[model samples]
Target: MVWTVMPDFEGYDEACSQFIWDLPASYNPAVDFLRKHENSDRVALEQAYPDGRREQYTFRELDELSDRLAVGLADLGVEAGDRVAVVVPQKPQNPITHLANWKLGAVSVPLTVLFGTDALRYRLDDAGVAVAVIDPTVRDDIDAVRDDCPALEHVIEIETNAPAGDVHAFEDVLTAPEHTDIEPYESTPDTDTAILYTSGSTGPPKGVRHSHALWLGRAAAAYNFFDQGLGPEATVWTPADWAWGAALGGTLFATWHHGGTIVGYPASGFEADEAFDLLAEFDVTRSFMPATALRLLMEVEDPTAAYDLAIETFAVGGESLTPEIVDWIAETFDSVTINEFYGQTELNLVVANNSNWFDTRPGSMGKPLPGYDLAILDPDAADRGVAERLPTGELGEIALRPHDRSVFFDEYWHMPEKTAAKEVEGWFVTGDLARQDDDGYVWFKSRKDDVIITSGYRVGPMEVESAILEHPDVVQAGVIGVPDDTRGEIIKAYVEAAEDAPAHETLREAIQSVVREHLAEYEYPREIEFADALPQTTSGKIRRKALQEWDAQGSVDEESP
Candidate 1:
């Protein structure tokens, strides 16, 4: 399954420019890939792990499974446009159920495993989900709230253990024979594909709506630019879930559309060595992960030399990547090739620094992707018109207007007020704050909502944590604004030390010194605490709100956040 560098259609600049240019009318992403392998025996899915266990589904096998599942759903009166809430961990069952729903033209509402009962209930109710596909761990929670969810009529369990009496098992559909007379449902490009829930730190998570057209448009753009150019066939490995825009928009959708095989670990979650082993074994051509995971891989020292393969691109997103991490990947993997992209749940990748052609500037998230009109606007200044783009070097809210492109979200599901708040005229305001440099590359700082203001100085917690992470002693860290008597807010950091380091005052002072030297005086952490681990979502980003709440509740409600 390994692939080496072959005939490339476009160079770096051309591929980067064309990926943006060819986005408007590309095919629908969901069905395109499935269609390509309908009549073939190509390994459509290689869902495997390093521990000598796996599930391999050929293209035809996958298509048939989707068909039978669609029939099973139809037999239960599941109709097109019905919202099916899926609350499952990272497993193969997730994708199988998702594609089945897609085949039936059903709208999927994917909830993260980290969600508590309240969060899950809100999403289920908000999206008017009638049926749920759940893992065993959360079956009791759904049973607890089933009465309140009037729209929710069925609970299909995808569990290793037996569930409560009224619930049906997910295996029943697969084990049963397909309905031969079932008519194939035609899904158009504009069909409502999914409603992915956003993980909002402050308020209720908004469900971002996307159509088949928008989904396919992103895949087409990737194929025409970096993908097809790299190789006609590519093997992609990513831990990206269907819920995240980057995973749904970038990896799985794009890979499938290009007839590429997905070589993922067989286990529920990712391990550092298993990932490397999979790449080496499959000759994985393209891979994607966050900078956090990349940092872990960098610790291996000579990772590429150890597991050699032709990795055409290393795509990263979810947070701002550090210069050291990018440098290590280039030296270990390839130079001028770490493609860092910028995006949120609300929008797909509006900007990207592609590995094909453009020169990467370490920490900078490259210029706006073609077709997206990116602007940095000062959210603090109300009088300033929407057209007023902030001067280069000044921090502002990152806004995007898709020009000559049909590749953006339809709207936030049932949350019109929140949707209006994020959009200005025609542009979508990515809650993230960033600044454009003189060279036109954008530099990410912090979330617009997560900004900390102390006295008169505005401080970004990312600046503090980014510097704190540099100290060899720290394993994980989260920086948040804590209310103070003197300053309105002061920087307080909760750090998880390396496995061997102890949580002591001396270590805290040393951590503070690291931040003070690397960042501005105001951006340094004034208070620090050493903990076993910092709170993180299923996606692994440090959850600052959880930390802020811990600081508010006297740190005793350590579990509250």
Candidate 2:
């Protein structure tokens, strides 16, 4: 399990200055989040279903289940280094599959249930997954693409009494007569654990292979963001699907790793009222929620007025958020800490805000978490084959030095050329743009490709959208650069207006005024179009590329959601 070295228990600055990573040579993710907690009577998990059914498992029960499943998988010809894919909701099978696979020293490939045929086929085939444990909801999608995946030999459906051709029932596998006798495979900090694909906001998705040390790398940042220390008293939860990296590492693994209780629900759709009910029922102390989920919660005129909430801390990441929304989240709950972090699939949870450490900066992603060396690098230097840091106030690409390999991914799976491109002069370059202030806070801009070139000035869509969202009538905003002969590229905004709000020139001019007042004159949107809704990624990030295509073709983009 995980433990914070807080024996001194002083302030944030002192802890960071004196902090150092103390990692063991050999480590296993399963041992840390599951196996090590064996035979304990403390409850480790809670699954609340929609039908008024509830299931709670103690640490001992989970460890024994993991043991039996490991043996069962071995009997199914699964061996060390095999790739096992998991596609399910927030159900018991999700964690069981991961724990069991790691016990056999296998790699897990998480796939979202919302993916279409092509999206599903590409990842499964690219990773060459041998076995898949999935919920019944996605059976047809997997069956439709099974023949295309040559390496995929077995499918274990979660709970289907009918047992179709070439598929094994999950219950049958777990109930087989083999006792829990197999020893967990020995693993080190360098042993492979998982392969999470990039969201591909700009291009096709690639598999990012990571080692078991991922949990170690995320420990400090998560601990600080969760308000410093967690123990059996902590109960954490999140609405994100199990397929996403933020939930898998930050919530599911981090909670158990810290000897805390984790709560989940098999929700097909996230109803804001239901979400609040679950939180109140479980007395969840901490959570990692996306900005989109928070926006939906805003629908409730008053949350505490409707339900009792025991939320202590909420960590937001996996998408961009407006400063207004972050502030609203804080004021909505009494005595709740809201922290925003910045990271992608390659390097997860490196930068974050710790309210106890320092006050929340409205628009800035806080200083680097302990154990990381972060910098703002010149975007053009990478193309010229060197890594150079930019001036403190100048905008540049955010990059991380390889000070410790435990926290970084090993490589992009099976793509050596692409992997090589990720590093330049010993720094793992993140293509997102940002700037550091004299106070050491980093403010996010836009993606490198999402930057707009207007006349001789460069602008980030994030800054513009944050300004536009300040208007009371605007519920959502997405900014992009469209082609213009006079200025080369003119800023455009796609907005979702409130029901009572007018979508005429009056509202457009008002939004433009807000942008002009908040940022430089050239950064305001030249044109605005109001839509019923904006297309977004599964994690709640606005798909600006989709907005660009929609503006180009003058129609909705059906290819991505």
Off by over 4 Å in 1: 1-30, 37-39, 49-51, 159-164, 175-184, 220-232, 266-270, 301-310, 334-336, 381-385, 556-561
lDDT of candidate 1 over 489-512, digit per residue (tens)? 998989888776655777888888
lDDT, residue 108, model 2: 95
TM-score of each: 0.89, 0.95
Clashing pairs in 1: 12-356, 12-357, 29-216, 48-265, 48-266, 49-266
Give me candidate 2's TM-score against the actual structure. Answer: 0.95
Candidate 2 regions off by >4 Å? 1-9, 504-506, 558-560
- What lDDT score goes with residue 121 in model 2? 89
Task: Please write out the lDDT profile of model 2 over residues 1-561, one tens digit for every residue.
Answer: 244332343666776677776666778777787656544778889989999999999877787788888887888999999999999888888888899999899999998887877888899999999999988888888999999999998899987876788899887778453588767779987889999998877888889999888877665567778886566788988999888888888778877877788897978887889999999999999988887687778778888888888898888886665676667777787878888888778886888877878878878888887767888999999766689899999999999864577678889989899889888888889898999999889999889888899998999998898888788888789999999999999999998888889756889999999999999999999999888889876666788888988998886554443
| Candidate No. with top lDDT | 2
